[model samples]
Target: MTNLALLGARLLIGALLIGGAVQKALSPGDAGGMLVGLGLPFALVWPALIYDALAGLALWLGVAVRPVALSAAAYCALTSFFHLNVFQATGDAWQMTIFVKNWAIAGGCLALMVAGSGAWALRADRP
Candidate 1:
């Protein structure tokens, strides 16, 4: 049961990252605009989009899962830091909720970084 839960968590995280990357890659212009609105540099946005896509693919393939997990954890850390100020200023419950959610997701990413994807990985058969 524990193994199943871990596998489920891994798949869910992998799927979310892949889907997010696809969204950003397919609509980079829009993603870039959002990044700009977030006050990040335009140059950073394109590179970040590429990193997200590649990392997502890596995670999905279970090729170098640890590295991919670390990358995802770092990305989530940056996101959490960026939103820390928003978390402080929010009077609305929804905003506060999302801020907490981001932190929780960051925690989950960190856990994946430490726990790894285990034996059911796509790269398991590789020598």
Candidate 2:
């Protein structure tokens, strides 16, 4: 049951990440505009898209889980810093809420990192 739960969680998180990456990659111009609004370099938007897409793939495939989790955690932390600190300074409560939400997701990723992909992963033969 616990393993099933873990696999379910992994699937959910992987789906969300993949969906988000697809959306961003498909509309990088719009995402870039949003990133610009968030005070990030517009050039970074493309890299962010690539990172999201690859990370999502990694998570979905259960390959290089540790590195993927670490990268994702780092990305989430940076995003939270920007939204919570920089954007919140502009008095956007909603944005701050989103930032907190990202932090929560990051926490989940951290847990997955420590717990690994369980027995249902494609990379189960590894390690």
Candidate 3:
């Protein structure tokens, strides 16, 4: 049951990341603009798309989960900052929701990192 739960968590997180990458890819202009608006280099979007897809895939396959989860957690926490200013008087409520959601996802990633992929994985990191 524990292993199943872990697998489910991995699948959910992985799918979310992959889907996010796809969404960003679909509107790279918007993504780049958002980054630029936040004073970040537009080029950052390219690497973000690649990293999200690869890291999500790794998580889905249960490969190097601890390291990947750690990175994903960090990624989520860091990216959440980009949405931090979405609570202004005229800011979109959805953006704020996404911001909080990122932190929640980060917490889940941290838990997965410590749990070490449970008992089911392509190559189990532990017995």
Candidate 4:
């Protein structure tokens, strides 16, 4: 397959997680507190960062696309479910927008899992 397709797919999904990872990594105190306030454990933040960072990097580099993308898809779905009670959230409602968006991203990740990484990738096939 053409590398452009892979590049587009990777960048589209990878950038989201990469940006999230960076944001969380940089200001985890606030994020962790927010998670705790949301009834989610604060202790999960660090491991999430690591997972997002690794999966983001893997997708960005087109390495182990299937496995990482599969995990990322699950992550996206769980995060969506985690935020399911946003109607009761004390935080801004805007944070709720990503519920559907994450599902869409998960769909894209599933597509990548089936398609594998295209050309110009570090490891184009599933690991």
Candidate 5:
């Protein structure tokens, strides 16, 4: 049961990242605009898309699970800041919800890091 749960978690997170990359790839102009709005370089969108795809693939394949999970956790936590705009109220309540969701995802990644890949993984790098 635990291994199954871990696999499910991995699948969910991996799919999320992969889907996000696909979305960004489909509409790079939109992604670039968002990055610029967040005070980031528009050129970053390309690298971010690649990183997300690669990281998602690594997690899905259960490769170096602990280290990948740790990196994913950090990625989630840092990216959540992009959604946060506490000072000036933009009247977009869903932004806050997304920010919280990112943190939750980060927490999940932390759990995955501690638990390793579990028994059902492709590589099963058990902690």
Candidate 6:
């Protein structure tokens, strides 16, 4: 039961990251626009996609979960902080929602970092 819960958590986090990467890949213009609008470099699109996808893969594959989760947590926190303008935009609640989601996802990543890989993982612990 415990391991199942952990696996489920991993899947959820992994899927979210991978799905985000896929979306960004499919719409580079939009992703680039958002990055630039947030005062971030547009070139960050590829790095964000690559890092998110890689960390997401680690979550799914249960490899170096602690480090991966920690990195992902930092990513989420950074994105969340920079996207604060979402809350200021008039008549736009969706941005705020996304910001909140980032915090939640960051919390989840922190939890995963502390939990370690439970079971059915490729690399449950450090060598």
TM-score of each: 0.72, 0.83, 0.93, 0.87, 0.91, 0.92
lDDT of each: 0.66, 0.74, 0.88, 0.82, 0.85, 0.85
Tens-digit lDDT track of model 1 for 6-125: 567677777767776688778777556545656877666567767777777766666677767777877776765445554455445654665566667667777876777666777742
TM-score of model 5 relative to the true fold?
0.91
Rank candidates by lDDT, best first. Answer: 3, 6, 5, 4, 2, 1
**Candidate 5, 11-117: lDDT as tens digits:** 89999899879988999987687678867799998888998898899889888888988998998888777777531346577778878999999999999999988
Worst 10 residues of 2 by lDDT: 118-127
Q: Write the per-residue lDDT of candidate 3 for residues 71-93, one digit (tens) a residue.
A: 99999998887777544533888
lDDT for model 3 comes to 0.88
- After superposing all C-alphas onto the true structure, candidate 3 shows an RMSD in angstroms of 1.4
Give candidate 2's error at residue 115 in angstroms: 0.5
Q: What is the lDDT of residue 38 in candidate 5?
A: 69
Tens digits of per-residue lDDT for model 2 on 1-127?
8668667767777776787778887877766776787777889877777787778877777777766777677778777776766455678787788788788888888887877777777785233
The residue-by-residue lDDT of candidate 4 on 1-127, one tens digit each, is 4578977898779888888889888899866876787788998899888888888889889888888889989999988855655535656576577677889889999998887888768877843
Best by TM-score: 3
Q: What is the lDDT of candidate 4?
A: 0.82
Q: What is the C-alpha RMSD of each candidate to the true structure, in Å?
A: 3.5, 2.3, 1.4, 2.2, 1.7, 1.7
Stretches off by above 4 angstroms in model 4 are none
lDDT of 6 by residue, 1-127 (tens): 8788888989999999999899889997777887787778899999989987898899999999999999999999888855567567544777788889999999999998888879769987542
The most accurate candidate by lDDT is 3
